[model samples]
Target: MTSPPRPEPRSRAAGGPDIVPVSPNPYRFRTGRVVLVLEGVLLLVLGVWGLAAAGEGTAPPAGAAVGPLQLTTAHAALLLGTGVLAVGCSVRRRSALAVVTAQAVGYAVLFLVGLVGAAHEVPTVLGFDYGDAVLHGGLMVIGLGLGMWMAGEGLEGLWWERRRRASRSDDHHRSGTSRSPS
Candidate 1:
């Protein structure tokens, strides 16, 4: 005689009783990382160029316009440090969100400073210029947009995961699957 047929295993993606929970897309995360790395490299290059101009004693101590890039020693240092930190964070899965958020906030502040300095017609050590303002504005938008999107994705995933767990617990209770203490 044939043995009793075994029950089919339930799949996570199975319909009806089981529900598929929303999750963060791995492709989006990868794309974000790539963009972060590219932006970091650009900042690094600009920083190095600004510093080189300063070292040559050609650019003024406060600021100078090198080709299309305008920067001072302080701005150059800031860029170099930030770029390095961003690149490091991009490689680490956990730090990406924090870094992006920080970058967005920092750029916003810098953009405002540039605007104020230009309005007053007095350089405030940041080497404020139209070119600098434009760059900062663009980066601010990109960073802020990406940061917010990532944060939303994280929250969505957490909410869905909690819901999935609660559903499983309810199912377990309804099915009388709990074993009694022997």
Candidate 2:
């Protein structure tokens, strides 16, 4: 016979909307994957275009640091390569939070770079009298928004629950109770 229906774990807060509780970071996992994949594709296209322009002798100066942020072929290649690797890992569903965390850090760094450029008169990442201070500023905002969404998913409770479950599993293993008799 089939077992009886089980109650879904739900919001403990009074007046909170009902939710079917699952793992600690399912939402982040999915969102992070999407973000990484999209970034990867976009970067790939941009990198190819940049490299083509460079080959045609119409590319901008390589590794020029007029502004705090340097616009170089290496920089574009690095961005594209990082995008590819991140997307590959995300597709395998590995280290999602770690990747997103790193991305957040990257955004913060870029923001600082943009700020440094703003302090100078020279143009920044876009070059040709255009400064990247605004673009990086926007990236900073987007990154923070993503982080807030991830945190709003009630991850703290899930972390504690995972620790408890792991402890229980360890206890069982210590007691040599990994299996049951038929």
Candidate 3:
């Protein structure tokens, strides 16, 4: 006189909350959020600093160009705004990869312009002495590494969540209950 089991829900149980967490490890999302916010704040600070450095023989409005690389006060402001958006979006979206990738590209361009072949002489970034082009190269490497780590961790979390949900579905289905709507 045994009874049948029920199929568990996918993403959420029947009549469950509309928004469900996607990871067993809650810290993953938190990490992504914190990192993005910090990065955004840094970018905004740099942007404001660049704007403040705009007057009195400041390196032209178009920013100093090193070979093929170009930077401007406007660009900094744009980046700052982008950072802010990234931070806000990160509350619901994965922004680590996007933000880090952008930073990586910027660093790469700087490296190419100043360290690739012959050296160019505008040795500063955000009005701070950059000593050599090595800093750009280093930052590029760090960004790339961080991006990879964040992507991998986030994706792994997703995979596990999906598997867990599927397991619940199987359990519910085996138990003979109607499968809950996802």
Candidate 4:
């Protein structure tokens, strides 16, 4: 059988006729950024609340309070750290990995604190219990999943940019246009 003819190479011009850069998807990036911002704000608020709770000395009349209000200092610190890291990454326009890493660390800390509080029976005004543990643990898992998804989207965006550039180059070559020098 006869071999198919080889295709002509594309032009290298900066604005070559063959080059059509596919626009990046803004929605994914925007959504991820929004989520990160919201989560960071929420964490910061929670941290502040924890600090305030740490100062209170009154215990609820119902179920056992997990521990003294001051015991939440560690939790407050972790939440504040997480929020700072997330906001810092966003402001710096760092890679999605940074955001993901921050979120993961934040969630892990939240989960660990919840687990410990439940296990040790420390009484907060909210009262430590298996239910609280489950709730906090579940939220942590959800945050982890969201972080991973954002990272994956960043990778996808990079791949898309590359593919679009290649396609443009190929188109230029097919049109028989001379490419401009870099």
Q: Which candidate has the highest TM-score of all?
A: 1
Model 3, position 22: C-alpha lDDT score: 48
- For model 1, how does the per-residue alpha-carbon lDDT over 29-95 read when each residue is reduced to its tens digit? 7788888888889889888887887667677645767678778888888888878877889976558
Task: Please give the clash total of every predicted structure, in order.
Answer: 0, 0, 10, 18
Cα-based lDDT for every prediction: 0.75, 0.55, 0.56, 0.56
Model 4 weakest 10-residue run by lDDT: 61-70
- Where does model 4 exceed 4 Å of error? 1-17, 20-24, 56-71, 92-96, 109-113, 122-135, 157-182
Candidate 3 lDDT, 81-108, residue by residue in tens? 7567656666654455666788788878
Distance from true position, residue 159, model 1, in Å?
Answer: 8.9
Checking candidate 3 for backbone clashes, the offending pairs are 4-175, 5-175, 5-176, 5-177, 6-172, 6-175, 6-177, 7-172, 7-173, 8-172
Candidate 3 lands at a TM-score of 0.51
Lowest summed lDDT over 10 consecutive residues: which window, candidate 3?
A: 123-132
Q: Report the alpha-carbon TM-score of model 2 versus the true structure.
A: 0.53
Superposed on all Cα atoms, the candidates' RMSDs to the truth, in angstroms, are 13.3, 12.8, 12.3, 11.4
1-182, model 4: which lDDT tens digit per residue?
44345333345564434432342554655667777777778767766776566546552322322332233555565656767665566653344446666556655665676667667644654444555566456547756765665555345642222223557778889899868998
Candidate 1, pairs of clashing residues: none
lDDT of 4: 0.56
